[model samples]
Target: MRFFWSTLSAIFVKDIVTELRSRQVLPTMIVLGMLIVWVLRMASEAILTSKAVMGPVALWISFLFSGLLVQERSFAAEQQHDCIYGLLLAPIDQGTIYLSKLLANTAMLCIFEIIIVPVVLVAFRLGPDTRWPALAGVLLLGNIGISSVGTLFSAVVRVSRARSSLLSVLVLVVLMPMMIPATFALLTVFGAVPETLQGTGALSFIGSFNAAVGYMIAFDAVFVVACWLLFGFAIKE
Candidate 1:
């Protein structure tokens, strides 16, 4: 148990330090994310009048697109000097490697969100009624779900010639189930609960919100465990 955690920490730290030194992955993600947000804002000027609607759309779009970079680069970083072979040869479970990469990717995505979310809220003028705690919970769950599936497929496509494109397709396809519910949940959080889910009683905002949160929690748990179990096979030579 100790060895597993230690190895995970070592790998996580190594990735973080290397990224900090290189200034590669995070910068690209942030710039692309900001650019997406900016373009969306510009495009929506004449069409969308609802800040509530546009804000979440822009935020998630930036996240989904920029996030691809994080996952794509997660394993590609090690490919430069055959460092991935070193990780594979290490005395640790492959699941540990997966967890470490998942953590690293999630951390980067969270940092991206920390910077992007506030700028989004201010830009969209979401107002003081925005639910900060609930929004934070949603982002956290979404990050874990994204990172879990992304890390697994990132490893799967690590050696592919078209890994960047392949990773985007795989991650987006697998993420649809989670992302749909998540988008609705964000809509609710941003004060635009879908008309179908609005009204009093069991199908109210609180109920729908709880349902979305529960689904994401289940999705994250299932994928993380499934990915951990399958990572060995996915990563093998």
Candidate 2:
């Protein structure tokens, strides 16, 4: 038990230190995210003057693609130097490796959100009425959803030359339920519409915010457990 926890910590720390030193994943995420935010800002002013409505959609677009960027490269880095195979040669279980990847990806996404969400808030002119705490909560859940499924699918396609494409499809399909609601709820909390009209027209309908939050938490949890069980098959040569 002690060894498992320690190994997990080491793996997580390794990813953090390497990323910090190299400045790969997060830089791309921030630059690309900023670009998306800027484009959205221009579009909002030029096309739709309504800040509330467009903010949510634009935010989702940024979040989804930026996350894809993270996941695609997460394992590719390992495979590049054949480091993942070295890790596999060790005594650690595949589940632990999966969790490490999941944790690292989730942590990176949280950090990205910390930086990007504020930019998003300012860009959309979301004022004092915006529920910062609630919005942060949603972003946290959304990260978990992305990381849970992403880790498994990343491992599944890690050996493929077209890994980026394959992982994108698997992730988007599994994640659609959670991301759609999280987006709508985020927009709602930012004053896109009243609670009564949570998923109405002109709004990408999923369901109520509270309900969406509850479901996504469960949804992510289930996938994490499934991935933990299934990752071994995905990892083997």
Candidate 3:
């Protein structure tokens, strides 16, 4: 237990320090997120009154792209100096590698959210009101699912010749089923017409979505573990 915790901490710290030294990922994500929100706001401004729904959609869209940016780098960094092989040579379990990578990716996503959410609110006139906390919860949960599957796919694609574009297509295709829960949660929080938790199926949709995705996290975790165990066989020196 202690070894696992220490190893995880060491890897997490290494990633944080390396990312800070590089300073590429976070800044690019923030700038891109800002541009996305700004563009969306400008587009919606010319539309009808009560620009309420666009708020959540803008944030989610920005977050999705930002996440892809971070996930892309997850394996790209390891591929740089063949540090991936070094990590694989380390005396660690495959699951640990997956967890560490997932942690780093999740941390990056949270940082992007921290910066993007405020910019989104200021630019789109969404206050701290109107179910912001609930929206945040859903985002966190959904990102966990996203980052898990993404960590696996990113590593898989890193070994392939196609790399970035191929990874993007494959991950996006696999992520389609997740769009419903994510969109429903976002729409409920930021839509012009919000759903209530009172009726029989009122909140059930979101609840079911959450539960289903929550169970899938374990499945996703297992898949990542399997991939980590198998990737070495596929990608040789």
Candidate 4:
């Protein structure tokens, strides 16, 4: 038990230290996040004002792609040196490796979220009446779901010919179904429509959507384990 925790901790720390020295993951996330935020905020201004209405969707879109950037960075670096194969040669379980990478990606996303969300709040002019906490939780949770699926898929795609193009196609296609909950949460956060017209059901819908994905966490765990088990077969080609 302690060994597992220690091993996980070591993996996480090593990834963090490597990234810090390179300063690769977080900076790119921040720059891309800022660019997305800037463009979206500018573009949306004519059509929207309420943060509750524009904020959630905008934030998710920004964060989602930013996360993809991190996913790419995480693997691309290791691939450059062929270090990924060395990790595979170690005695650790494949699932542990998946979890470690997932956690690292999640951590990077959270950091970027913290930095970018404030800009979103300011740019969108969110109101005091808005449900900030609920919005934040929804974004964070939905992102976890996206990142989990993304990390696994990214790993699979990175080894293919036309890796970058193939990865983009695969990820974008797979992401569509997952975007529904995130959309619901964003709509609820923006709350742009009048109460009498917007329907009170958005909150319930968002909550239920979040809960649904939250339930999928266990499924994600299992899925990643399966992916880990199969990864060796795929990579051996």
Candidate 5:
């Protein structure tokens, strides 16, 4: 167990250091997120009334697009010097490798959210009355589901020639259903809309944010474990 964890930490550090040196994914995530929000805001400027719904929707759209690109870039970065090859040759468990990648992706996504969340709040005029800590917690849960699944799909389609398109299709297809719960959860958490606890099929972001967070955590955990178990086959293919 200690060896597995140690190996996971080493790979996680390797990825983080490599990303910092390259300065690739973070910049793109920041840039893309900002550009998308700004553009969307500008586009909606003509509408005089509320941007109430558009705000969170726009924020998530930016997150989804930027996240997809960054996930692809995560593996692409490994291709630069065949770094993944070296990792593969190491006596690390395949599950450890998957977990390391998931953790690294989650870290990157969290940083991206840190930058993007403020932009989102300011752009949507949601700053003053908002609960920063609660918002952060909600976003973290949502991103866990996103990055965990994305990291797995990114690995699955790592070496494909048409990786971007394929990954975008697959990730969006799988995750779009999640957006209903996520959007409502965000809306509820942000207090953009009224509470939805009355009837949300058991999980209620309105009355219980923890339930929503736990739901996403469960979602991520299931996928992460599945990917960790299947990653060796993915590598071989």
Candidate 6:
């Protein structure tokens, strides 16, 4: 157990340090995310009055696009100078590698969100009455869902010729299930659910913010465990 944690921390730290030195992944993600937010805000100017609807949509669209870059670059440093081979050869569990990478990616995305979320709220005019704690919870679960699956598939496509494009497609397709509930949860947090879904019925739970959050928790758990289990095989050369 100690060994597992130590290895995970060492690899996680290495990734953080590498990105800090290179200034590669995070900068691109932030710039692309900000640009995306700006473009969406501009394009949807007519609907800007609907902050409840547009704010969450814009925030997530920015996250999805910018987060793709993070996954695409997850193994880029390792691919250089055959460093991936060295990591694979070392006395480290592949699951450890996956966890470390997942943590690093989540950290980066969270930082991205910290910057972009405020800008989104301001641009969309989502006022101080917003349910910040609930929004934060939804974002954290969404991040885990994205980072877990993305990190796994990033390794799966690490050696492919069209890795960047392939990673984007795979992550998006696999994440659809999680993304829907997450987006709904975000809308619920922003108090944006339509009146139709609020009435009593089997479908009414969809309007319950906690239900969506619970679904995200389950999605994150299932994917993280499944990905951790399959990562060793996925990384095989």
Candidates in order: C-alpha RMSD to true structure:
2.9, 2.1, 3.7, 3.7, 2.8, 2.3
Candidates ranked, most accurate by lDDT first:
1, 6, 2, 5, 3, 4
Model 4, range 1-237, lDDT digits (tens) per residue?
Answer: 787777777787888889889897788779888888888777787776655666766777887788788877667666788988887787876667777777888887888888998888888776535576866666667667767766777677766667667666666676665565556645644565322223356344435544544544544556556666775554442
TM-score of decoy 3: 0.83
C-alpha lDDT of candidate 1 relative to the true structure: 0.86
Model 1 weakest 10-residue run by lDDT? 198-207
lDDT of each: 0.86, 0.83, 0.75, 0.69, 0.77, 0.84
**Which residues of candidate 5, in runs, are more than 4 Å off?**
47-49, 128-130, 197-214
C-alpha root-mean-square deviation, candidate 6: 2.3
Span of ten consecutive residues with least summed lDDT in model 2: 195-204
Give lDDT: candidate 1, residue 73.
90
Writing each residue's lDDT as its tens digit, candidate 1 over 1-237 gives: 898888989989988898999899888888898888788788778796687888888888888888889998999888878999998898888889999999999999999999999888888888426478888889999999999999899888988999999999999999988887688778888877653475664335335777878888999999999999999999999
* Shift in Å, residue 51, candidate 1: 1.3
Better of 2 and 5 by TM-score: 2
Question: How well does candidate 4 score on lDDT at residue 175?
Answer: 66
TM-score of each: 0.93, 0.92, 0.83, 0.82, 0.88, 0.93
lDDT of 5: 0.77
Writing each residue's lDDT as its tens digit, candidate 2 over 8-99 gives: 89999999898999998899999999999999899888885678877777777888888988888778889998998798999888899999
Clashing pairs in 2: none
